[model samples]
Structures are given as structure tokens and as C-alpha cells.
Target: MAKPKKISTLNQSIWPYLSPRHWPTWFGVGIAWLLAHLPWKLQRFLGKQVGRLIHKVSARRRNICLTNLQLCYPTMTQNEREQLTKKHFESMGMGFFEMLISWFFPVEHTAPRVTFSGEALLKETFEQGKGCVIIGGHFSSIDLCGGQMTRFVKVHPIYKLQSNPVLNWIMERQRERTFEKTIERSNMREVVKTLKDNCAVWYAVDQDYGRKASVFAPFFGVNCATIAHIGKVSRITDAPVLLYDYYRTETGYHISLQATPDGFPYLDDVENAVAMNKMMEKLINSKKEQYFWTHRRFKTQINEGDKDPY
Candidate 1:
């Protein structure tokens, strides 16, 4: 009989420093590190498997995805909608692996795989000596896409703090490698200052932030509570607003930047919010599966009588 293989003792030495609660987090990081070294195609294949598993087990999130799909694509048949949801989950899974790749792998490795368009616009905006607000909607490939943007322009990304300290630390470290500065989402003064310094600020405004600083705008024909800060920031800094969006393609990742119309935030807050939503809608329609559908985009109801969709 063959001798039993000895168990690998690689991480055993660090076991003492980790609490029971932290083991899972570290285990996940370990897996992500391994995944990061794999070929992009293979990593994406494994990510699809992971996504399918999550879709099978995560009933709440699965339902939310389905609900969003239903709300957004009302005319589609049930079968078609379900297919899109599955595809979206697969893309989400790939996005997870891509996030690992973005943080751990060198930009040179991905540089060949990405094609950037409209970089001249970014350069032009920078030359103008007023800051630029790069607005984008949440997409599955966002992390990797943002990583690629760093190669073209030094941007200050505004991010929400993760609840997990270890994860947050790791993520911030990774972002610091690319971004000139990382500002907390709540730090409006810092954001304004960054803009005033003629730096690029990357902001994603698709998530639901409730009604306080938000206006009801139509996203996929559904009234969504959209954040109003994009216009406010632009007005305050007197900076130009530009839309930067990305999606995966057969060749590789495709990133594009386009300036918003002159006099954006025209008329009123509602109009500005509507314009932003329209831009998001166009990007989502380009590659529906890559859009971040799992988010509760329509969480906040427009009125008391309006029913919660998720």
C-alpha cells in the first residue's frame, strides 16, 4: 500500500495568531491568493462555479437578483429572465476572482488584456486644471476596471469602509498601490479638496443611499432613490463630470470615458439625477450580465404607498 501523503504545513505556523472567527476570512484570502496566480480564463471558470454554488444556496440574494431582473426586464419571458440572472451570477463570480487578480497581480500582467478608449478625454480634462469627477455605475468588473484606470490617470477613489478590519486593510493597501489617495465616502470636504487640486476622483453612484440626500430617479423605468452628491460636488468644485464605464469582451476588458453634457445638473436636482440614471442605464444595457444586479437598487420607496420591490 502507498504511504499516506503528509498534510501540507504551510500556514500551520500562523494558526496561533488567528481566532476562530478570523480563520474563515484568512482561508478566503488564501484561496484568493491562489486564484490570483491562475490564468485569467481558469480563474474565471472557477469563479463561475463559485457563483453557481452561491446562487443555489443564497436564497435571499438570489431572490433579490430575480426581483431586480423582473423589474428591469418586464417584457422578457420568465425563462429568459432566469437565464440572465444565472449569467449575471456567473459574471459576479468572475468578478470576485478578478478582484483578487486586481489586488495581487501586477498591472503589466493585465495591461495587455485591457483596451482603453477615450483616454485623450481624460488627459484633456486634466490639462484644463480643474478636477474631473469620473462617475460610473456599479458593475461586476468594477474593481479590475478601476485598477486599469490607474495606469492612465492617478485617481482618488472614494470608497465605503468595509466592516471587516483585516479585509479592509488588505483592500486599502491594494488600492493605495494604484490610487493617489483613497477618501472615505463620507468625507465631502476631502473630495472637494481633491477636485480643487485638479486630481481625478472616481465615484460610483448606483447604490441606494436612502432619501435624505437622494432624489427619486428612474433606473430601468423604476423610480430609484439616486444620490444627488454628483451634481453638488461638480457645482462646488466647478469641475467637469465625465462618465467612465467598462465591460468584459471576448478579447478582454474594454474601458471607455465620455464627458457628460455641458450644463449637467441643469435645471434642478431631479433633472441631474435623471441624467445620471440615464447614463447608467446605457452602460448597463451594453452588457447587462456585468451590471451589479445583486444590489438592492430600488430599496428606498418613492412614497409611503409604494411597495418595496426587494
Candidate 2:
């Protein structure tokens, strides 16, 4: 038999397709819309089946989830971690399809299925006439949370580019449909300029940033690679930082919005920004299970020659 060709890296092949961002979302939304029209019981049954498929296919990702879960929650038993890991993957699989319809197809069509709580935070921040920084993590239905906020404020989120061109192009287009504007990580200047305009800058600083752009922040008592750009953004723009998270509830999605500085205080310096980021880390740890533990967040191993201190 002939040797099979190896697949190229996603960055090289699929990054281009995601730049436009809307068309692929439209594609996903179309599928989601159809799924929504099905009988309620049937939709749920299909969702569960999809979740199982995700577990089966992403074997490596499941292992990473287990490793992270154990590292973050050393107190939990192995069986407990295994169960939660399965639940996390199942929730994510269903959430992905649900969001496809909610964010892309039509707001009126899908918004009713879920409800938001901290809507006032968005309005209050926008009314202040100063830009605000909304920080969130890679949780289930994170896109839905950001999409809902867009209803009140023109949110410009910094999104990491995807490796698959076709999939990336699809998602970028989908996101643009809801967000006021979209910014990529490669353009640092534009991100700064966006905040300078008094527009909200949404950043998900939950993942690794290698060694250069990262700092060793205490996550579950271990030094985890945390990005410093979020703190930098707050320092540079003097934007009020808010901790935001959206999780799945029995009825729908519940958004938790917390305003720091106790209503209003001077947070105009890098030191203050760093302090605020520490608080964010603690808030994330409070609900460890709800976070996206499957991600290779601590993948960056520190080298001996590295000069940065934790």
C-alpha cells in the first residue's frame, strides 16, 4: 500500500478562511436553526448524542481535561474528576450548536431560549461614556454571553485566530455579525486605538501566552501562565475592569457581572490593574468546574534561561 500523506498544520491551511468570520457562522446558524425547529425532546436527544460523539473523537482533549482537572482540583477524587470531565464535554458540544443558531441566525429567533441577568452592567458601563474592559474565560456558551452584551454596548473582542482556514473564516464572520467590531491578536496597535475611542474591549485572558507575553499567576496555588496584556490594556486605557462569566443554568444561561472598586474608585495605574487581575484569577478559581478545563492552558513550560519572575 502507498504511504498516506500527513495533514498540514491548521495555521497554515485553515487560518485564511476565518478572517471574514460571517459566512461560516451563517453556515452553523443555518444548521442550528433547523435543529431548533425539531421537537424539543428530539433536539435534546440529538444534543446528547452529539456530546457522546465529541467524547469519543477528542480522546486526547479528554485526557488533557483530566490532567487539568486533577491539577486544579487536587482535593477531588479521580472518579469525581472523570465524571465532571464528561459532563463538561457534553455541555460544550450542546452549547456550541445552540450558540450557532442564537448568535448567527436571528436574535429574535434564538434569544428567547436563554435569558441574561447582568444586562445593567453593560448599560451602566456604556452610559459612563468611558470604555470598560469585560474579561471572561473559555467557558461553555462564552460567545453567547458576549453576544448578549452586544445588545447594549458595542463590544470589540480580541479573538485568537483559528488554525483551520475554512472554520476560522466561518467563525470570524459569525462573530462580526453580533459584535460591534472584531480584532485579531496580531494587531496590537489597533486594540489600543479601539480602547482609546472609549469603546469596550473584551479580552479572554484565560489561556497560555508562552513565556514572553505571560506571567506566572497563581491558579489553584500553582503558577499558571497568565497573559499580561489584559492588565496592560487596563493600565493604558484606564478602563474600568469587570469580571464576567456566563454559565448554564437549569432554566437558561445566568450571567454574573461584578463591578470592581466598589462602584467607583481610581484605577488609573499599572499597579491597580495588576491588583484587579489578581482578583479576576480568584473569581475564576471559585467556580473551577464551570471553566473550560480541557484547554492546554498550562502547556508553556518555563525554561532555565527565562528571566521573568512569577
Highest-scoring model, TM-score:
1
Q: What lDDT is reached at residue 300 by model 1? A: 88
The lDDT of each candidate is 0.84, 0.66
lDDT of 2 at 59: 85
Which residue runs of candidate 2 sit more than 4 Å off their true CA positions?
Answer: 1-41, 102-104, 119-124, 261-289, 304-310
User: Per-residue lDDT of 197-272 in model 1, one digit per residue for the tens?
Assistant: 9998988988998888799989889898998878788888888888998998876798888988778856488898
- Count clashing residue pairs per candidate: 0, 13
Report each candidate's C-alpha RMSD, comma-separated, in the order given: 7.7, 6.4
Candidate 1 ranges beyond 4 A from true positions: 1-21, 304-307
In candidate 2, residue 197 scores what lDDT? 84
Q: How good is model 1 by TM-score?
A: 0.91
